[model samples]
Target: MPDRSLNADTVPAAGPHDVPKAQQAVEERLIDTVLQSFADCEDPRLGQVMQALVRHLHAFVREVRLTEEEWDKAIEFLTEVGHITDDRRQEFILLSDVLGASMQTINVNNEACGDATEATVFGPFFVDDAPRIEQGGDISGGAVGQPCWVEGTVRDTEGSPVPNARIEVWEADEDGFYDLQYTDDRVSGRAHLFSDDEGGFRFWGLTPTPYPIPHDGPVGRMLAATGRSPMRASHLHFMVTAPQLRTLVTHIFVRGDELLESDTVFGVKDSLIKDFVQQPADAPTPDGRELGDRTWARARFDIVLAPA
Candidate 1:
């Protein structure tokens, strides 16, 4: 009745209505807009996700009355973040870490812990296809720091050994730097090993030190803007997968690592800390090598797998 004669062709698909109905009408319009935005998406799952994203994003924009200037600045930041990504680096992941999105993702996907080891975030620094080495071998390559013997067992939650499990492990060196971050020294300490026939794995490395992640990019700018340091605590990363078992990605943190309470990415949890024990030089290493005149710290922890 209201303007049907003058602007009959200009009516919105949704009508301006009673105050309560107004919101419902707008929501319906938004849903339709989201659906149309992803109409050409190829992946069905991705399409669904993108549609949801659009709906939420639109809602946020409307609720906040986001201004043109602020939105343009947001776009500029995201564009620069993308520009900093490369084959071995991901600035988007860095952004996610600082914003706590990466930790949220880890919690969402790793929902089970039936005697199985708890899972944690896979940080932006993973390297695919690291060098493989034998169990009980020295991975440290004498990088000057506290020596530690890292030994562990792979087992099912039922207490049975999980033989043939693939254990991918890597850690920062003595000065708290990853081999890749400093040099192309592929020959350095970071390496991979597998559980033996008895579901046991072993290696040696210098104690990890707290170090800052590269803050030379857009992510760094964000951290600086927020007064946050780019440092991560000393810890070792492990990913293990076995037959009919769930894959696990987690970190074994140094008990005394100062950044445990303030891990730059908020990735630290008390349950993940492990002690590195100092032992006399005469003690036998897991390798049966005489701990010849070398003081060492020994840490033993096991990973329990969940059945598929």
Candidate 2:
């Protein structure tokens, strides 16, 4: 009860010349009222968060003078986003990604430490229980794309080998579709493997290629309205995890990809871009697997993880 009532001096003078100021005082009172409701919240953190959220939301509404019609439209759009979200599709994540919210959260959480590999947005396509592959084995699993040899070592920031680290890798095919996008139960273009005793691992995957995110839903409409493209840069996804180390969800972009500068998710990092060297169709394969006449590519990505 510390003077919850507004002081006359704190409010604008009641006169014809103070219409805007009076309205602002009223709005501020509303914000205070909403904030007070959370005062008795048992959790201090929740109360603090709720109060901040209320303040910001009210400030936004006041700054924009948001119209009822616009608010209604936003509600409608979010409803559509919820309706379209299901097992295979996540329109909410797509919305967050396109707005750079995902990358912003990553940036806030991932601090620069030593030469540790930077983190990026984890696209919604990752699935649990992916097929496992042996070292130097093929993860493509018959996906349609040029073969790519992906080799890498997992090391700590001190450059110590992290043996038996779990690495999950996945990517879309040449046609710009993940295996889950197909109507059938086909599992390809994704797999997991553990680092060797020496922290080395290699596998065959499809060459990274640029692809538009899933964009036939409400999120797509939003993008179209804003004059933005949904294309992500050519890249491959990796999630590396080891004991007592920070788990990393990142991607390696192909150097010189046109979409790198404007990736829809804003997930590209200069440190993550690597060269994918193309080889002749008759070039020898790393594991000596015969690839009739199709050319292949190779890339090496050495990862350094930060302490947990």
Candidate 3:
């Protein structure tokens, strides 16, 4: 209170105790000044986040002796990332993916995977509320490469079946491209389904294939600059929710997908991979198409949920 405005700019003269005192004084003042900037924020969460962000940003600038040129380049990169975002795509999520921030967040929040199935990253390609189908149904309604049959049980951590559970599933075709990626006329490989009284559901779809994520944007360029691949491993996406249960969103990777070791988004987990093999032509399918003649991959994976 003693003329802080006047004293703030005046550094103590160099002396035996002067350096330490000056350093402490500067630290205290910097913290106060930074926090004061956020004191006007109405939301407590926003204020806390802004203050922490500023503290870390300033600390980084000081610690690295950050160059103005480097800062400008960073600003440019961030602006590009923001500018490329829209309803179907989010560059920030892509940024988080490349930096491994998204996986770290998932790890921190989903640390309780003792016996329940392990959780994995949620990719950005999902469209909420797919059309609902029934057990033993097929989600893939478009051009399928290899017919795949996926049947699974929905159960809680205690091994109890979750009745009437809603299971949302989607995946890329054998070509590593989603339905949305193709022309507007295709719809063979997109559908949704629900569980039964015994918490069982089944679906048929095409075998997923290793494919590249969208690489025409800045994230793609960044990956190229870093010499990293832009391919996501073959996998099936599922989101399950029911009353009194923890909602789960995850992927069931196809074993031996080429990109399993190097998924562009780092979403692959060894535990998430399952056997998706080909069946003979004698197998009964809703389409009644000969199986091996066209090469099909069959997979059955059960999801173990956490109690609410």
Candidate 4:
């Protein structure tokens, strides 16, 4: 007890590796414990996924030396995301899109089959049972924007027309808002129609315009905090399906959009970028539906489906 108050000479000197080695061991042990807990998962795939997830998650936390406060903040952010999600709004998908996770998953699942239209992110705005339209009918459904004539032919990988293929199209309006984003029960800028016997279809829709992904929520906040823009390149969504053919979900991005290189969702593909030919106000409309003085646009997107 008389010598308990030790001087520097009496105290043990610490090596540079000593503290880190002990901390590393503790972190590894925790990771091992979490992995073991998932070992008994009934599904083999689930067990594999859970174990891998735990490993990576632990590694991330360790690499960053994540603080308790940071972890708590993350949980709080996710809670807000869940709270804001609903049938019409999907904050999680927005998060995944912005993080490039959505595009990565799409790239993994969608193999590059020769000449098949490349697939892209299935955005959060698609809704089932969209109003059907006849060939060359208007899909605008009273949504406001510049008129655009969209036409395309559905074909198989073998270069043959695929008739009766169902095409679902949806997009945001000039204001960068989907029909579902409004307060009322309104449906516009979305419709579904079947490819004709000749595998051809056309519809009047709005000219694809640059729009921000819903940026008034937690995802928006994250984008701001990270100094990232939420602007998506102008695009038109398409989901084409037919019997014995692989269903294709993709978008046609505006060819010259400045944001094409930095689309918030990473949804642009070189093959999917197409020219939207501009028309003079006096130019005749595709379906002879006249717009007194509005300058419209036209885009042709030929789709090639792979065998299912």
TM-score of each: 0.83, 0.93, 0.83, 0.92
Best by TM-score: 2
**Which prediction has the highest lDDT against the true structure?**
2
Q: Cα RMSD (Å) per model?
A: 6.7, 5.8, 7.1, 5.9
Judge candidate 1 against the unseen true structure and give its global Cα lDDT, from 0 to 1. Answer: 0.79
Error of 4 at 4 (Å): 33
Give the better candidate number (1 or 4) by TM-score: 4
Instruction: Please give the lDDT score at residue 63 for candidate 1.
Output: 57
**Which segments of candidate 2 are over 4 A away from where they belong?**
1-19
Q: Which pairs of residues clash in candidate 3, taking residues 3 or more apart in a chain or in different chains?
A: 133-192, 140-188, 140-189, 141-187, 141-188, 141-189, 142-188, 142-189
Please write out the lDDT profile of model 2 over residues 154-248, one tens digit for every residue: 99999999999999999999999999889898999999999998899999999999999988989998888999998999999999999999999
* Off by more than 4 A, model 1: 1-32, 39-44, 141-144, 280-294
The number of clashing residue pairs in each candidate reads 1, 0, 8, 0
**Candidates' C-alpha lDDT:** 0.79, 0.91, 0.76, 0.90
Choose 1 or 4, whichever is better by lDDT.
Answer: 4
Instruction: Put down candidate 4 lDDT per residue, 115-154, tens digits, no spaces.
Output: 9999999988899989999888888889999999999899
Q: Can you give the lDDT of residue 239 in candidate 2?
A: 97
**Candidate 4: worst 10 consecutive residues by lDDT?**
10-19
